[model samples]
Target chain A: MNRDTLAAREPLLLGAPAPVLAGGGAALALVLAAAAALLGRRELAAPGLEIVALVVLAVAGVAAVLLASPFRAPFTAGAHAAVLGLVLLAVVLDAAAQDGRNAVVADDWGPMVLPVFLLVLATLRPPREVLLGGVLAAAASSAAVAALSPEPLRGVAAVLTGVLPPAIAATALGATTLRALRRGGARAVTRSDAASVQEEAVARLEAEAIPLLAAVEDAGTITAAQAERARAIAAGLRAALVADLARGWLADAGFRVDDPDGYAERMTAAQRTALRTTVASLPLADFERPGLASVRGQDRDAVLELALPVAARPRRTRVAPLVPLLRSAFARADVRIGDEQVSVRVELTVPR
Target chain B: MSDAVWTPRFALSDGLRAAGLWYGGTALALALASAALVVGDLRAVAVLAVPVAVIAAGGLLLVLPLPRPVAVAAATVVMTAGATAALVVLARSAAPPASTAAFPLPPLKIAMLAFGVNAGRRRAPLIAGVAITAVTETAAGLVGPALGVPWAFDLPATAGLALVALASSGFLVGGRRTAVARRASRTAAEQDVLARTRAIARSRAAAVVHDTVLGDLAALAAIGAGPLPPAAAARVRSTLDLLASPGWADPAAPPDAVGGPVLAAIARAEDPDFSVRLDGELAALRGLDGAVEGALAAAIEQCLTNARIHAGVEGADVTVLADRDGLTVMVADAGAGFDPDAVDPDRLGLSTAVVARVEAVGGSVRVFARPGVGTTVLLAVPKAAGP
Candidate 1:
């Protein structure tokens, strides 16, 4: 349903175990034969080699199963080549066994080989799928050998011994792979949840910080003690914001419980830039117009506008929304310029 | 009273001690296991026996009070040594006959080198532990045959190989866990600091609001109950205007004009002749705020009040000067001045309140006077990073 769940499910459903099982079998045979030769029992080496060739053929069967897996783009032609090599080796081994150099050739081997080939073709060539396919192939081959062998009971025992270990291992491998995928999916969900919480916290902090700052501005004449308190408060707010930002950044980046200084620094820079641009874009009234210019000269209005660009901006546009809040914060104040004076208005802007 | 009580025994110190003990016990167990292996009884019983005894001892130690770092270090060292020895034995046993002469070097030396480097670097000890485990496994593969161990290094021996693989995987998992734990701890600490800071800021903002706006509003309400005297009403009006002024928001305006009305209102409380001078272009003092103006006005008024009360002066001269660099205000009186050194900043009167007020706005105030000579107060205010 979720991205992570999909990631987990897709991998498991599409994973083919046949390749891994067949490859593992081939590798085991090769390694055993190589070891037998290296150990210097020359006469017994041929049977080992024949086994190696058969294992290679089994590997090709596994490859075919792997190709059947969903999303088999990653498994290339080289994998197919490896499977073909296995078939060639199996043929060579069968020929050598017939020559009686040193081969353990069972009479009803064709039926055993056919099931392996069919099993390989049924599953796609993903390692997990291939492993599963190999197990099935081994099972089928063992059953066929038991049914067709002259000593049916002995054949059954032999087949069971030969196929059971690999089958159990293949199944175990598939289970482990599936478990890992599920765990990964769960972890991804947890991370996303954490990230969402962090983001919500950050947004809350930002919303809180702006109002707090505005309140500080509204607080009438600050004493030395009050200023110190304000400084402390500012520092505290900054720290809180930093923490929230760090958490959010880490969560978004999928950093579970890790130091996010590097990420936070980058995010803070971007936030600061956004804040600055917002501030700069805010429409502030410009009131520095020359006092007598509008009355004194024909071009005086333009001159006044040029001189006090900020003051010349329409007051309507520069309307302060937080004026009432600020008014409640400070005492009434007056100034005397000659005999006539106007009142000072304080306004605060609450950042959203 | 309960909050003030200092109970030392129930503190974080005990927890730290417990942590240490736990680590120490773990170290001792690891050491014993390694020692047992080094003594070389290659029995399955020995493999199971030594580790179990060590773990039990470690678990017991954990309950005892001890320093955490010491316990952890000790445990880490012991585990490292034990793990290293195990790998060494495994590697030696697994070596091919032809490669047996170089047996110990490949597995044992590599593990030792990794452990030593990691210890020196003071990185994740768990990673070192895993390397040691891997090396020991390799060694076991080489030497197991010579030692006549039942397990042989050969194909079709999936059970034996799987066990080794599982151990190696465990090592990797342990390393990752350690890394994650360390990272989590650091993030938590940093987050705590940040949370504390934010709380402090919020408290400060609340305090500031209480002192400024709330105080002013209360004063306004009190004055509004009755018809204010004519002079007082004018002063109140001016004060209200100043409070509402846009210039108060500017961070670079002169203190006097910025909040002049508020102080003028306060001065009107006692003296009807109280007045403010705005000598320079008001536009030039663009960044002044309400607080700085209030402080400046209060300081001048305080000086005047002091002169009238202490020096028997009739009136004081107040002059405000604004320039590109800064603003200066001189409040001089014909009243007699006292010794500057005699004034304590903590004193209740003008020296403490007025001088402090001026300074709070990034300004300096100086009083000069002699016996029978008028005292003059010179105040200089700067306009930067202040209200």
Candidate 2:
């Protein structure tokens, strides 16, 4: 159920597939138009308009790719408008380039190709937005032909045949798809959460202690080794519980820092584990003052600084092994052994 | 164990339906476009375009993500406009019959299909067919005398479209029903597993308490009327420390030995005051289910305690038998025994503690006892089936 819903798979839907569909549709439309122009070059009265229309459509195609890019954020209404507007302009230009030739309307790729772009638009935005844009584009292109052509009735009829049906069909199909996704997302099963935390803890403890108890039972008496192992396990279990009860390991480890916003929660389990291990590896005397830590905001990043006393003079080799681990956890990890103090600084990308 | 393992019932169907819609809708649109192109009379094609454009615009209204009532009303207005345009075109003496007949079919049917798909946003596609039938019938009636040429409504074709709509809706509904049932059954299974797990954990926790804190208390009682011995005092202090420690519930390393649960139960029940002797194939309990082991251990401990307290016996014998069907455990004692039927059902001894605990793990319990004859409790549990 985690990735079953449309909302969960939104990234996948918008990722490679969106761009492929949009780019592919735009490319095919452009290719067909270019091929038609070449095949009917002699029939084209205003070749200048045709050349300008092709260039305009090429721009729209590029814009479509950009809008559909998975790397970019969800496109806005303004971006949708701008791209569709460009396509519409090129369409009118393509029609005008036919020089009022009624027989050539079906051959004009503008109306024929417009629906493909509309379908591409459907991929990036909501169904309602795409439908609105498609309708406006269809109406304007159809009206332009009806007004500019010498044979107004044939012009309108041709534009209707090429544009309206496909555009309407695409809208119906796109809307159905979008509506299904929305309904699916709404009904997706909820995932297990903190409700299982207690069970998990109890199960972990049972797993550890059951064998020792069984061994003791088999021998009919507790050995010194077994007693010692039991005591050690108890101590370890105690430490873990204390850390959990106190909210985190940092406080129990004797480190001090002010994080009122609780940004540390954003760190994954691996990152937190690395930080705990790295700090635990260092000697208490190495710090400027034992168990002291500091945090400062540096623009968009949070900088955590741990200072070591100059007299401690921890060797470079002592810190070298830990740099990679800290670096892996954070984007920037700096360990400087200056004359005044040996300090470690880590830069964390502050979550919005 | 992860939520990713399960998939909802309708997850695939919704997508397939969408794909079908696109394929069907696109094919219809293309066919209409092709027909318009094939026709030679440009003058008639122009007149035919009116109804087609009107229908296309009306059909597109179904694509809007609007409330059901609003969409229906909007579609009505646009569809009515389209019918009016169709009427005007049919009435014209110059309009060709071929162009007029083909013009309204594609766009009107697509609109009808769209309505079927988007009806009430989630209604069955049959609703769209029903609504389209009414509209088409009305249009045919109004245009029946188009310049003395009676226009006919195609009922069979409309019925076919309705059947298509009904089939699509049935597929969606059937898939949704199957998914819901699957999800419910899986959820129930998961909850049952979780309950068994929780029971096992509780049993383990109880065993630990008996081993440590209760053992220390017994040791203290044994050293009566004097200052506690060094070892005993140390043990008491360690128990206190453990009780007060924050990580008391921390995860422990898993036990290495199999059959540990049963062995541990026998050991915990083997008190100086109450001895327990184990016999039979104890090794057979190895690799058994944790729940079965925990339940058996808890039940055996209770039985031993009962023999010591009520039966006035110093020791008991435990026998374990294992075969293909399952494992059976019997704890017998020879001493003063009371009739099991005479015991109150509410008593938290043999009935609640032993019987309920064993039965919880898909096992059964049989208690045999009579006054002065001693008592024997038999517990049978099935093997742990492979995952």
TM per prediction = 0.25, 0.41
Each prediction's DockQ?
0.01, 0.02
Model 1: docking quality category? incorrect
Residue range with the least summed lDDT across 10 consecutive positions in model 1 chain A: A299-308
> Tens digit of lDDT per residue, candidate 2, span B1-387?
145532332433344345334533553455345445544545655665666566556655665667656766566567656655654554452543332223334334544454445444235445655666566656655664554545554422343353334334433443342342233334433443343333233333434454565565345334434444567656655655554444332212111112566767666676657766555544356547877788888888888778877888888888877755678899999988777767855336887789888888888899888899999989887765222
lDDT of 1 by residue, B194-274 (tens): 432332223223322233433433343344333334543344345344433432322111112223353343334345343
- What is the CAPRI rating of model 2's predicted complex? incorrect
lDDT score at residue B163, model 2, on the 0-100 scale = 34
Error of 1 at A203 (Å): 14
lDDT of each prediction vs. the true structure?
0.37, 0.56
Candidate 1, residue B236: Cα displacement in angstroms equals 21
Off by over 4 Å in 1: A1-30, A37-131, A136-160, A176-352, B1-387
Model 2 chain A worst lDDT run, 10 consecutive residues:
A1-10
How much does each candidate deviate at the interface, measured as C-alpha RMSD after superposition?
22.0, 16.9
